[model samples]
Structure formats: structure tokens, C-alpha cells
Target: MKKISPKELHERMQGEEKVLLLDVRVEEKYNEYHIEDSQVLCLNIPKTVIFNLEERDELAQITKEQPIVVTCTTGNSATKCADILDGLGYQVEVLEGGLTAWNEYRK
Candidate 1:
């Protein structure tokens, strides 16, 4: 999976880029604040235990060829999500350092 810094991701978002920015943090955290156009998909729950994987259906909405970037509080959760997506044959990337880095660099 490709890895990108938050600053670079922010710049891409500013431009006319068709990118899927995913925030893997919790819903409450996301409700507090998140980058523009970012979709929330928390990875705190165990993927194996969560049978209704298609609950959100965001994965189905997006094509595997699309540029998907995952982000969490500190990038670990996002990395895990990226791995799962990658294994499923999706073109995914992880935002290095995640939202923390983004907040530090951009805000």
C-alpha cells in the first residue's frame, strides 16, 4: 500500500483530485473534527467479529481502482484498514501519522 503524509494529502484534497479519504477513528472523534470530504470508518471493532462488513457499503460504493487513503488517530488503525483493503484487491494507501500529523502540519 502507498503511504502519504497528511500535508501531501491535504494538498491533494485542495486540488481537483478524485481521492477517497477515510478516517478510521471512532464516530465520536470524527464527529468532533475531521478533514474535509473525509469518510469515517472506525477500525476499533474487530473485523472478524463484525459480520456485517457491508453495513456501511462505502467499500462497494468505491471502485477498487480508485485512490483510497486511510487515516486514524496515529495511523496504526488506518494501516490495518489499508492492509485489509489491499488484500481485497483495492488500491489503498495509509496516511502516515494520520490525523495527529495532519492537525500538526495543517492546523
Candidate 2:
């Protein structure tokens, strides 16, 4: 799967490039922290749900028009989620190093 660095994502959002973020972390973790910006639309769908979901409509929040960045606490789960999204035909990329890397990048 493709990967996007936090710096690249931050630049894209800052440039007003609309982005869709599929955060595969649990809702509680997602609520604790997540990417937020005017140009970003984030969706909190746990990795477990994405793995077991059968109906496509359940993922209606995602669209093919925009490239999606999948994220988790670490990059592992996001990579798995990206593979699933790829199979489902979504334009997907994983956030490299996931949110941990992002936090470090910001620091």
C-alpha cells in the first residue's frame, strides 16, 4: 500500500487540498486525539469494524473523489485497513508511522 508522511499530509491540508482521513483507531482513542483542520474530514471507523463490515453502504462516509489517509496509533493497523480499502477499490494510503510519528513530527 501507498504511504503518506505526516509532513506531506500537513502540507496538503495547509495548502487547502481537501483530504479525507479514515482513522481506524477505536472511538475512544480517536476522541482523545486526531488530525483536525479546515481542509480535512475525518472518519472514526475502528479497524475491527472495517475488517468485518459486509455492506458497502456502511462505508458511505468514504468517497473515491478524494484520496483517503488511513491512520492508527501505530502504522500497522492502518496498513491493514488500507489493504482492505484497496480491495474495496478506494484510493487509499496509510499514514506512515501513524499518529505516533505524526506527534513526533509536530514536536
Candidate 3:
């Protein structure tokens, strides 16, 4: 599994990197707060458990080669999802410290 810092992600997005931000929190949490920027596209795929196949299959609609960044409240859930996606041959990176890290960085 791969990991990326929130600051680096923001820098990359600022540079116009086409990265996918996959938020694994529940719908309510995702709606509450998330990384919002024009340069990066973000999608919410709630994961009640680690690597739900249904969600994974649904995400298959997107190209596998896309730079995918997985995030959650504390970064724990994203790890599981990242591991699963990596095993499936998708290049997945976890948001270091997850949303907390992002929130702090923005502050």
C-alpha cells in the first residue's frame, strides 16, 4: 500500500494533478466535510467494512490507472480499502492521517 501526505496532495492538486479522492466515510460524514477543490475529483463510497466488494465493483466503473487517494475520518478505514484496491491491481494511495490531517493542514 502507498501513502501520501495531505500537504503534498494539496500541492499536487494545485499543480493540476488529475487524482481521484475516494472518501470511505459514511454518507452523513462525507456530507459533513471533505476536501473540496476544482483540480481534484472526489467521490464518496461508504464502507461499513473493509473493502466491501459491492463498492469496489461499483468503483470499477472508473479507470484503474487513475491516481486514487483513499481517505477516511482517521485514515484507518482507508488503509483497508487501499490494501484491497492495491491487491486488485489498482494503484491506491492512502491519505496520511486521513481527513484529520487534511483539516489540520488547511488550518
Candidate 4:
């Protein structure tokens, strides 16, 4: 799997590039705070769902058209999710250090 830093993600958003963010965090956590921007399409699918569900319909909003960047509270869960996406033939990247790093970078 590939990896992307919070700085790089921020730069991409600033450049007006479309970003597909797959947040593997729980829905409540995602609703509280997440990467938001006009260029970003963020999906809040819990890590457990991604691990337990076989239906891709829940992930229908996301496509193989763009590279996906998965994130969680930390990098661990996102890494697992990225691996699953990679196995499923999608180009995926883990958000290095996840949202914690992102929050720090934003400061």
C-alpha cells in the first residue's frame, strides 16, 4: 500500500484537486471532526464495517476512478483498510499518522 502525509493532502486540497477520503473511523468520531474541503468527498465508514461487510454497495460512493486515502484516529486502522482496498484492486493509500497527524499539521 502507498502512504500520504497530511501536508501532501492539504496541498492537494489547496490545488483544487478532487480527493476521495475514506475515513475508517466510527461515524460519531467522523461527525465530530474530519478533513473537509470543497475538493474533498469524505466517506465515514467505520473500520468494522469495512472488515465485516462484503457488500461494496455501502462503498458505492467511492469508485476506482480516483486514488483513495484511508484514515482513522491513528494510522493503524487506516493501514488495515488500505490493505483491504489494495487487495480489491483499487489504488489506495494510508494517511500517514492519520487524523491525529492531520490535526497537528493544521495547527
Error of 2 at 46 (Å): 0.7
Return the number of clashes found in candidate 2.
0
lDDT of 3 by residue, 20-82 (tens): 899999989999988888887898887664355654556755677888899999899999888
Cα lDDT of candidate 2 equals 0.89
Q: Pick the candidate with the highest lDDT.
A: 2
Candidate 1 lDDT, tens digit per residue, 34-89?
Answer: 77654332333323322246653545666777777778788887888788878778
Q: After superposition, how far is residue 28 of candidate 4 from its true place, in Å?
A: 0.8
Clashing pairs in 3: none
Clashes of each: 0, 0, 0, 0
TM for every model, in the order presented, reads 0.77, 0.92, 0.90, 0.92
lDDT scores of the candidates, listed in order: 0.70, 0.89, 0.84, 0.88
Give the Å error, residue 79, model 2. Answer: 0.2
With candidate 1 superimposed using the best TM-score fit, by how many Å does residue 75's alpha carbon deviate from the native?
0.1
Q: Considering summed lDDT, which 10 consecutive residues are worst modelled in model 3?
A: 48-57
Compared to the true structure, candidate 4 yields what TM-score?
A: 0.92
Which wins on TM-score, candidate 1 or candidate 3?
A: 3
Question: In lDDT terms, how accurate is model 4?
Answer: 0.88
